[model samples]
Target: MGKGGKACDASTQNRAAWLHGVNDLRIQPYPLPPLGPTDVRVRMKAVGICGSDVHYLKTMSCGDYKVKEPMVIGHECAGIIEEVGSEITSLVPGDRVALEPGQGCWRCDRCKEGSYNLCPDMEFFATPPIHGSLADQIVHPGNLCFKLPDNVSLEEGAMCEPLSVGVYGCRRAKVGAETTVLIIGAGPIGLVTLLAARAFGAPRIVVADVDDHRLSVAKTLGADQVVKVSFNKEDVASEVEEIKKAMRKGIDVTLDCAGFEKTVSTAFGATRNGGKVCLIGMGHCNMNVPLTPAASREVDVLGVFRYKNTWPQCIEFISSGKIDVKPLITHRFGFSQEEVVEAFETSARGGNAIKVMFNL
Candidate 1:
């Protein structure tokens, strides 16, 4: 245990999966930090493997955040509250909750302005030095934890992380009944965005991807149309026309879940004049595209970085049955040493798996 009091009874084991180096993971005992006055200790029950987690396992780095030291690996998670600090009042022991991985410095201007996701001093779980929630227990802020409704499972609660991204993106793009949406990429993020757009009353949605299986998944998840595109740059213009033809209408909003330059270009070219293109995927650190053409057409390209206050809306969407995320979870593993390795591999391979989960 770390700080004021011991983490639960010292007798119980607190095992966690840690990433030591590239492609190396070890399950070992972890120390629970002493709870602060506003903290609550959570006993993790479910964790979902994210694409960024796989990136760290494969390269020991995710964008600018690198694993300079051994760190626990997970961010999408839900758990039962085991204990609450002296000043904690919103949660109690036995309360099932979804953990929001990012905690902002409330003192920052961005945080005060309700854009805490953009706070420069944010500490997100499983990023660099911050340990994640894929463990026996974790000490977290009560404010960052949200209580799940009676119908919501721990696994569904964990799904909220990805769903929050989709919800936030849709909100940012102002999708509505009059808008026709074009979603680029049929991966997990894209699929969630499709669900969110539909829930937000998008009249028509067309999804494009390089994989047939993923496109099929998008179709099953309420996408009005799915287009399988080629990897050839020379074929992009024709593909965009095909996509627009499939929609049978101009795209009022485009959500690029695949951050490749090719997808961004397709989005810019396919959207109607004065439409909005929101970029959610982080596939490329730097991308070069036709900015002048998009500008001339009045098409706006927006960038997304994680999410802000979206947990309650995500839970409501799940509980109300507006969006079902359970289908996205294709593989599940236990928290054993070998199982952890397999989970990471399945997520990294990314063939049929949309979301790989850990059943703790």
Candidate 2:
């Protein structure tokens, strides 16, 4: 909408936010990659900083994804299509869309089975060598880019990325009217899971978190009750009981968005026999917890690796007013050198800033 107008010029150079090292991000010009036949070039309009992005900026790695080189940083984004490749017919120039960050190798066994998120050859954005979409322009697969509905703004479209994770988690846990859900953690992901669970018709929802502010936000977003907890090991049992008491029913499904050993253990402890524990957080790679007891009770531990076939439902939830993600976006910044640094810092501080967004 600025320099490129409706379509980016062929010779136009794209400016991207690159993470060179820990706490180091720069706005620099980068050469655009060759667009494949089925790809579409998009001019980014909205980009939200994710927890993984903040982790990488703070520690130079997220889980096993280390920043070996200067990589563009961001995945939750929405943009206007600036150009379409030869074989791309689903989208055209000027289409506002939300991007699905991962593209799997179609030949993989996981892809064939419809769980492409597990594909070993998946080239996901902001994961190591894969460049992200926090730039002036990006070339992405047309199929992975879903056109936003008329009612959804570009910022709302970008929020779909995080919402998809919650939707996918709820779907996997099979939340329904008869189920009593206990969501551990009231961060952005936890709050979205609460909204998703309610949308999926979970009769009772109790959100547990250490922070009262976050818990209040969750309650405002339709959580039936909110319980405050701490990380103390001694508090785990009590917290579990508190969460269950708040729910006022046996926990049918526990979506652990904190992923700490304590949180995961509480999820297991609180869940009813033959219930589910969906671990959606990536707080720790390895955790020591009482898994034997939960498993012996037939309480299943479910893990989420991003999401699959979730954008359409996420968009529908937003467009149909079943979910409201705009309130989650508490902080906004412009796509500038100074603003980018400030925005990341605000997100990293992790107090009032739930979802930090960049208006590119």
Candidate 3:
């Protein structure tokens, strides 16, 4: 960690990567508002490029969230705490932490029930109207930031954001020591899910992906089997058979990290009777799959929104050596206009680049 700075004063210069419009990103000055009693000013260090970030960059929208105004464009971030608010006691200056991006309205029923990720009024960073952390500095709620243990690097700290998705997905699917798991897609989310499933003590895990590089990465990450599939839906049946054979056992759970129609179909076909299929991808918002047969077989489908109450466990996983996310970070960039463009391009093009990060 670097030396901490003072609070946002007249001398504190803040700049952010702002998405002005579709394919339009600019590095410009961002004025900081006064820090509230529970806020902490974080000196941004490492921020990763998520699929949704590139989606918003290229098309100006992701799902229903549209970039109506110039908003900062990053969320998977880790930083050093430079200034703490008056009422804060959990963290202090020089603390390295991973930030949980979404902020829910405390008054919502969802928040009261501990399912704040479902809150309708949630203001997540880099989601539509909310500004993100791809800046030199930003003030955020201290409670949202989880301190990094000594063993975790800043980049690995940033990875806790994606790792949370895997942890939550595994939790939803109920993967455990007795469960045989199959993971569809070998992208970042899929890889993290593989790690989470392994850490959760899944007896056997198989990963399927369309890319050889991704599958190879999965194999190196300790997947029992890595099966390759084509983009064509025609390969679904044969691919599922291959996956079943590779597992050599009934798959109790299947995580469709790639939400294409074929992937979902394969997940249904491969999962054992009375098994579970968890949908963790956003590749397709709507798809027609063999639902009736899956329902007849009692293959329950599960859905995952962002994540809820996962950061602490994610940090514990990284620090405990139960999950190693450093290998998934395949690229890095500095905070420059050219590097920003290159970073997003590498991530959006997505072949070999798994996790693209920025070192501010």
- What are the Cα lDDT values of the candidates? 0.91, 0.90, 0.90
Q: Candidate 2's error at 219, in angstroms? A: 0.7
What is the C-alpha lDDT profile of model 3 across 143-169, one tens digit per residue?
A: 999999899989998999999999999
1-360 in candidate 2: lDDT tens per residue? 111112334444779999998899999875676777988889999999999999999999888878888888999999999999899888989999999999998998899999999999888988977888899998888999999999999999999999999999999999988989999999999998998998899988999899999988998999989999998978988887777788887899999998998898899999999999999997877889999999899999899989999999999999999999999999999989999999999999999999999998
Local lDDT at 264 for model 2: 89
Q: List clashing residue pairs in candidate 2.
A: none
Q: TM-score each candidate.
A: 0.97, 0.96, 0.96
Global fold similarity of model 2 (TM-score): 0.96
Clashes of each: 0, 0, 0
TM-score of 1: 0.97
Worst 10 residues of 1 by lDDT: 1-10
Residue pairs in collision within model 1: none
TM-score rank order: 1, 2, 3
Better of 1 and 2 by lDDT: 1
